[model samples]
Target: MPGLDLPAAATWGRLTTFLAVYETGSVRAAADQLHVTPPAVSAAIAALDAALGTPLFGKSGRGIIPTDAGETFAGYVRKMLGLLAEAAGAVRDADRGRVRIGAVATASEYVLPPLMASFIDEHPHVELSLSVLPRDELFARARDHAVDLVLAGRPPRLSGLVTNARRPNRLVLVGRPGLKTDPLTATWLLTGLGSGTRDTALSLLTRLQASPPLLTLGTSGAVVAAACQGLGVTLVHEAAVRAQLDSGELVSYTVPGTPMDRPWQLCTTSEPTSATRLFLAHVCDPGRVGAAAFHTRHRPQG
Candidate 1:
């Protein structure tokens, strides 16, 4: 096994058995999970151990446990299996002309609906599924290939994904009319933790040495709604509250170094599906509805 090179098919089979045994703690239990005989499970593990030139498991009383090397190798096996499953899903979705998309709250609430409406109108045959989550969870789903694409603020450095900045995302501090006080002094209505809006608000507050928020809402819409009721000042995406700002229901404040700007990005796997590519083009095309909705700029008054 000095230069062991197992066949891909055998490797997958062996790894599958190894994972089952590692998880179940016994060959018989692994066989039960795989709908195979205990001897078959034992044979697969033996084959894997022989190929790797190392003992993967050690026998205990009526059970088995993975060795240190097996533990380290199991991580890679899980990733490989996950990738394989994603590949299968991608192929199925491509055949069915389906695209799954994940978006952060702001994009889901304000940006995607109009664009999706237009896209569906044009590409009526494409089946679409969209999930709106916090930025962190959205990125996680994108990285896992649970969604074909993700629309959100730019994610942190991720190795296996590609992020294209589709438009500018502007964050502004907003409050009701006649409430012109220091942002630090006013009660703050914030979105839940892990949202892009909340992250921006926390950063701005930190820079200003402001106190913690008085209240927290789960969604950006709720935070804006609370602010509109004259409850407290809140930092939110300008796109999310454009109608209120335009209607004078809420007024924007120009805090020092205000309007933190970031990019609204389209994130996808390195090898995106055809459906993903089609949707990305639709969003990026300047003449399309997505571009207009995403790129529209709003100037805030102090």
Candidate 2:
């Protein structure tokens, strides 16, 4: 046991590193998650431990385990980090700030609305704009700094772009209930070429070298409608098709390598502005937003 004296170890960087390590239980994993070197994470942890006069972690054979004290500290750390995000967002919105974001069709259309709503509710002074673009165009704009941030499914490896955070995403192969299972005989449905769902389907079909009768619908909604009418099977975001799937209008099929597991990445070019950072943090850390923000809207006033 060591003395629990609060000292100079309370710096923001160390707190962030500590939380990452506490959550991940691995220095290497925390470093990768924070986009920092392993040594940096180790140094921060060691400094924090020294300040508190106790080691936060202990070696458990081949793995590291959090100490009893470490677990106790984590409860407070979570609250402090949440407040940090809120305070930073509020202060950053002091100026008339603007941020431009580009995203793939699925992310922009289905994923970002609630997040944007929560951000707008919290930072009413901040102005936000969104652009829906193809994957290549999104990266092109991100590279040239035309867009401040991008949200999409797994970015391509490129120089100078930084991925700030990643969230889980799912792509499922959905069709009418008990529909034909033959890919060769079925008409493969597709949305616009800009759509990620279209890309996933095209990539799978390409790899399988099976080109069925193709139906090019313009939008995801329309494609889902066609699939409901038994036009063809389509790959789409699982969240997007949940209603139909639940009602027996649509059913997910277990195709090879699907439903595909993927990640929605938040990325940016060099040195994003404070506004962009605020939005990025808010979206990536959904728990950071207070529940009151969402409920505050459309509440009946006394």
Candidate 3:
């Protein structure tokens, strides 16, 4: 049996080349990023295949498609690179006091700016890096120790993490200013595919069991845009549509007896780090309240 030399067994050059390719998905692009010639990138890949005893990429029309082994290896490579970057970030933070935060797009757009602004104003020396991702990515980044704090919806469950509930977000129905009230047959506007908004709309419709209504949009933005254009009624965040509602560009509707409340939560890994604690303090403060107050003030007096 040939003795395995671990150093030779793991192809570092090829791994670097592979990461560049996997990230950019183009050999030429990877070469450009690495400041190497295309032929050198190709050679590194070939060397990697020789060391691993497997073909990595299969040529397609113009670009290359990763083989199954390549696909699996790429996943690990991404993790490894992420870990390396995170370690470096941790070292840097120790020297220069910084906080890293991750958030889902909705939270980033609607929830974070004000709280983070206040945090920054108070602690300007604490550098901040906030990345916006989808839910899965947000949790994965938090789980992987890539970020110090995660601002997002409550995950179904938590492991190696703790969460604190923040101000809740209300999902409300919206329509153009002149929308007529016909409870029996109002054309319901809704969000597009693969969105939680769409899912919420579907659930509400199912619960309400109104006649299968029209499909007027393919995205949450589309739903709002269609509503603005007077196409149909749609569901949106009360805060997000506040300006339009106040300006008479849009109007809100209540679900009669059912209120849709989705709470936002801030999460941190177990053994809350100083950065996480500080961010949590800021986000959880009563002064950092969301637009719930706006909804309360505008709601018709009973």
Query: How are the candidates ranked when ordered by TM-score, highest leading?
Result: 3, 1, 2
Candidate 2 residues 190-266, lDDT tens each? 98977767877889988777888899998888889999999998888886797898898998886677878766778
- What candidate 3 gets wrong by more than 4 Å, as runs, is 1-20, 31-37, 40-51, 92-95, 156-158, 181-192, 210-222, 256-258, 271-273, 286-302
Which digits, one per residue and each the tens of the lDDT, describe model 3 over residues 1-302? Answer: 13434247445566779978877889999999999999989887776677667878988899987899899887676666555655555554342456778876566766678777877887776678889766656667676666767766555254776665455567788887655665325777765454566666777777777664576566556677788887778777666676788898987767653346765667767754555556666655666544421121222222
Native-referenced Cα lDDT, model 2: 0.76
Give TM-scores for every candidate, taking all chains together and pairing residue i with residue i: 0.69, 0.62, 0.74
* Whole-structure CA lDDT of model 1: 0.77
